[model samples]
Target: MVEDYRTHPNLAKIKIVLVETSHPGNIGAVARAMKNMGLSQLVLVNPKEFPSQVASVRASGAADVLNDAQVVASLDDAIADCQVVVGASARMRKVSWPQLDVRQTAQLAMETVSADAQAQVAILFGREDSGLSNAEMDKCHYLAHIPTNPTYSSLNIAAAVQVFVYEFLMATDIKSVHQAEGYRHQLASAEQLEGFYDHLYQALQDIAFLDPSKNARFMRRMRRLFNRSQLDVKEIDILRGILTAAQRQSNQLKTLTQDRD
Candidate 1:
């Protein structure tokens, strides 16, 4: 039964979350959209209206999704196990945050989800009027923006969910085929990658290559490059080992110089 359910090429991780939704109709519509894309997990955090007849009617045949949907008190509780969180935002903000276009965000989600079986991925949609607040967006590791007309960028909540979920389903399908064919690359888990980054950063600091006084500007760029590359588990492990060896060599050299002096 598990194999049968997972045989679909588009199958991805769980926990699609909607936050602060004002309209039950939109919630139902969003559930329908998720089912269309073969996604089943749905979470609602502090919705304005739920269990409404309007939502059930709008869900049409996807009423099962609504019936099984989890209602949470807070966003943190909803996404606690998710390693990768993608927040959809229509408007740009003054403060800087990591952003990914829908396509790229979908790819990252697939990579992260497939890397570890236990890893959860979340796609967060905000309320209709304002979209995600800065605090809510900040909770996400990455921000996702859909490409739309500049003249009129107003997308309904259900519509936005449809666009993102479509991209996600497509990307997951393509990646799954490539993976089955042994043609796709793998990526390290966030925990593994973070450990590698820490070792690399420490090695660079020891060599004076990374200036401590500069406030990690260069380190951030290196992080971006790695994220774009999507290094696999083996790749990250190998790199971390190399960094460790280099650091050891540097320490040995320092000891030799001190003894000679």
Candidate 2:
């Protein structure tokens, strides 16, 4: 009874994010894979190599995908407007996160777009050697892992993307869910979240809760918590206001200390 996702209007809202990619050919291959699955949105974050003829040769006839691809400086920029973000990683970290198999991840991503007409989904694939880092994974609501031979389980970034994209198309059920009229307000974007993080860090520094020189583990954990909460625009504003007030108070306390000294 469900309509084909290939023809679904929301299908266009899905975005593929590649972070710190090394090889140009993988970029081209990813483009080809996306095109094969009727996906067009492609974002590259700090790729080591791009605009190479090797990529063009690999892309074959799917050069249009490469031509239209967005090159960004950071993952935050790439996924700024997306309502949902999923990161693909095979490595397990010390801290546990909500994990999903490729199939469920695809289903969840498709269902998000189906629920809200304005919703955009981002599936993040990381660098060839390391995949996503702990800091990067904190930005994702869920971690998707592709099941492979545990003995030898590495998958190429482009091939992994194709597998997930294919799952998305097959998992989607377009007929059951009706798109909502609109979201009450747009969800806080990754860009906005980055701004919030900067503000929070400054506030923490002002109060001496965090040292500027040392890279702390707590920050990553905090990011994981906030990302899972899915804060909206209003919530972000309130938090920013709180941080500003805290900064002001910290400044006044510092002034008193300096005078006493």
lDDT of 2 at 154: 90
- Model 1 compared with the native: what TM-score? 0.66
Best by lDDT: 2
For candidate 1, lDDT tens digit of each residue in 1-261? Answer: 122333553354756799989999999998898888778889999999888899999998998888889999998778866666778888876656688898887777776666555666788988888778866765566778887899998998889888887777777643334346564444455556567777888898777687667636676657656755656667887888888888899999999999999
The per-residue C-alpha lDDT of model 2 at residue 75 equals 81
Q: lDDT of each prediction vs. the true structure?
A: 0.75, 0.82
After aligning candidate 1 to the native by TM-score, how far in Å is the CA of 211 from where it should be? 20
Please give the lDDT score for candidate 1. Answer: 0.75
Model 2 residue runs over 4 Å out of place are 174-183, 211-215, 255-261
Candidate 1: residue 31 Cα off by (Å): 0.3
